[model samples]
Target chain A: MQIVLAILVGGAFGFVLDRIGATNPNVITGMLTLRRLRLMKTILLAIGTGSILMFGGQMLGLVEVGHMSVKAAYIGVFIGGLLLGAGWAASGFCPGTGVCAAATGRRDALFFIAGGLLGAAAYMATYPAWKASGLLADIAGGKVTLGTVPGSAYAGIWAVSGDLLGIVLGLVFVLVAFVLPEGIGGGHVQEMPAE
Target chain B: MTLDWKLGGILLGAVFFAAVLLVKPIGVSTQFVILDGIVADAVSPDFITQTDEGWTSTNAYMAKSSGKYAASAAGPLNYGFVFVLAMAVGAFLSSMLRGGVPLAERRAPEIWRANFGDTPWRRYAVAFAGGFVVLYGARLAGGCTSGHMMSGMMQTALSGYIFAAGAFLAAVPTAMLIYKEG
Candidate 1:
């Protein structure tokens, strides 16, 4: 039933990642430094395409709004983002990519996965303590489900209309990928540390 | 036609099909369970705790994990963990089929050598530390790379946009530095 369809869908996603070298950390790392455009291009494409499908589906009533979880927490997000970003710069693979890379038998990816698990586990284990201590006890939303963080007016566009917003962002993502081939290529980006 | 898109459609399409054919959907929060199981076994006291009502715990387990499972993020049996595992399995199976396995790079550059130890153990340790910091941050941020960026943006999540900026800003530099050393 639904589960069956899910498996098929998942397999395809993984297949694409593998074929595109999404499972390769070298690609991710390269893309970040602006050396490789391959992996970034794939990511941009996924985002652009995914957004369009979601918007169109919702607009057509093909799916429920509830399916798209919109809840957001900025404080947790900000700190966590900083940490994850630094990690990516260091390790090259995000959580999902790292796991996939590990499966591909990449030694570094395995290490990344192992580290990811530990980090995630630690966060959860300490959540209760952090909550009780009031360290993160009062951290609340600076924005709503749609979220709001200054410096990005493009979001105001999204807020005006989900459908319009979806189309615009989706198109923009693709446009960026297309215009800056080097910025978002596949597994062979041009990045590397400046010696 | 974008080569990445065509390949993305076909490859991810395959992942999509395989997911439907195998077990459940793909996700990372779901992997919390496997992580829980492993960390629990690896570290004593296991985070999961059994109660009169059942188990009450954190993101993954002590077998006491709660909050959300696969079917939904709010309930039990969180299948999100399963998706992460499936991602791993699928990738593993594919590489195996291709006859290509993990290979260590012994020719790391001098810059990299300075930043990281020349040994595998040291390199893995640094990576582990990096993973730990990132995942810990991801949860605090209310999501991981997937949650805040891909899934978040798909939902038109403002948080996702902000998260993406932060991610790229930091990640891009790191990649460049490493690539240089390598």
Candidate 2:
């Protein structure tokens, strides 16, 4: 039952991603370069809508907060994020979008997926050394949320409940998404280089 | 008709919310780890067993401890694996319905040509390198854009925000540097 649900949901997700033009490397790189603002608006809107529904569901006790998993914070995460960012800028495909692109029959995206698999295999091969390097060590209360807010929890800097704050921020995101100009990059469909 | 970006984005959010309600958080990277495990297992029967040093093997860790690990130690047949496969199928179906197969006649775009030139080898090389670095970094960071930035931030997790800041801080400058020509 769960597997079926996963496939359905994942399929829907992929369909949406493709429809938004996220499967296009040009669109992705354009967003990274601040030339195309449409994808950014789409991303922000998705995040905002998800945040509102998620937190709102939590407030209503319809959603289980425990079901939401939080990633751990460490110096490694930030540094790794920087690396991922650079990669995204260069390749214009993150893990998810890479898969989507490949599905759309882009041969380059297949190569990208192959590279990512090899990379993941390399990470597994060297896992012991990296784990012992202390770079992956958790810090600043790993898995922290706004409720914890690092050092500010006791000071009440984020006095509002995390869910409420999330809703407020989500609304702000929705507002920004609406206000952002479309066709900033002229919505030009650049022809892909012949394979 | 093609869905507009806003409606598509909202629909994505709705699907994500429903998925989270039904199962667990949505992510894509762990599927790669599961694939790695399956490949390793195919090469060796003892691929999943623990070593004498008490260190967890990749398969073991993926099966037992990874955040988005499968429901069982089923390797390639696991839930996460199936979900990712389904995602591909979905994309393919969408493309098919929209027209024919959405194969790219040209791989790179004008900006890429202006910056990186039209060498196929260079483009492929950079893409491979980029994929490797991104996955490696995502593993180290415990999440990728989808897992950390999207789901984590939706829940107001500080790590998500921090990761987003790092991603943008690096991505913007890198993009500018590489594609410097206006």
Candidate 3:
């Protein structure tokens, strides 16, 4: 039953990702290069909507806070993220969308997936070394949220509740998405029609 | 007809909500870890055990008995793997429905060609390098875009915001450098 639900949800997730033009390398690179804003709008909208639903649901008792998993903060993550960004710009696909692009029959995507798998294997092979180096170690309050806010109970100067703050930020994202002009580089660059 | 991105966002959010309600937050990088475990297991029966001390050692998250019974199962074939495989299948189906194939002869886009060139080998090489860097970085960071940017940000985790900022900060400049105008 759980596996079945996973398939259904994962499939739906993939479908939505493709439908939003995420499976296209050009669309992704365009967003990164500021040649397009569609993908940005899409991502902001999705994140904003998710924030509203997750936090709002929690506040209303419709969603359990325990279900939400927060990742830990560390210097490694920040530094690694900068590298990941460079990778995304270079390859035009992040890990998730790369898989989707492969499934969608993008031949280059298959190579990207192969490369990703090799990378994962390499990381595992060097796991002990990285761990020893403290590059992979969790630091600076692992699993922290706005509620915890690291050293203080409140985040920033407003002293708003964490959940409330999240919702406000989400709203801000939505507003930005709506306000940003579309097709920054003249118009949307359409990829070869699927095939 | 393809859904507008805003509508797509809502649909994606709905799916994520359902996933959280039924299972846990959605992520993809851990699936690679599971793949590594499976590959290791295939090569040697005691691969994971020897490397990680125990089957459950590296997979404590999946081994834990949670709200769902399937969550307690131990091994690489856990829920995360299933979800990722399902995503691939879903993507294939969606592509076919939209008149796309599982493989395209011409893969790289105009921007890629303009920046890199039209050579397939060059494209593949760069892609492989990019993949290596991204995945390596993701593991070091404990998550990738979906795990941190999507799921973490939704939960208002500070790491998510920080990572997102770092990603764009580096990506924009890197892209500009690579694709400098003539």
Best by lDDT: 2
Query: What TM-score against the true fold does each predicted structure earn?
Result: 0.76, 0.87, 0.87
Arranged by lDDT with the best first, the candidates are 2, 3, 1
Candidate 3, residue B149: CA error in Å? Answer: 0.5
lDDT of 1 by residue, A1-195 (tens): 544444445444554566666665555655666656666666666677666665665577654444555435455566667778889777766777777777676676677777777787787667766556544432234334352323233233223666667668778876775676654333332222222
Q: Give me candidate 1's TM-score against the actual structure.
A: 0.76
Error of 2 at B83 (Å): 1.5
Instruction: Name model 2 segments beyond 4 Å from true.
Output: A148-159, A183-195, B50-73, B100-106, B109-111, B114-117, B180-182
DockQ of each: 0.39, 0.57, 0.54
Which fraction of the native contacts appears in each prediction? 0.48, 0.67, 0.68
lDDT of 1 by residue, B42-109 (tens): 46543444456555443432332242321242233334544565667666666566555424332332
Report lDDT (Cα) of residue A75, candidate 1: 51
Which residues of candidate 3, in runs, are more than 4 Å off?
A148-159, A186-188, A191-195, B50-74, B101-106, B180-182
Per-residue CA lDDT of candidate 2, range A1-195, in tens?
878887888888788777777777777877887877778888888888998998788788888766777777788889878988999888888889889878887666777788888888777767677678887776766767776322222211255677778788889888998998764453344523333
Clashing pairs in 2: A192-B106, A193-B106
Considering the two chains of model 3, state its CAPRI-style docking category: medium
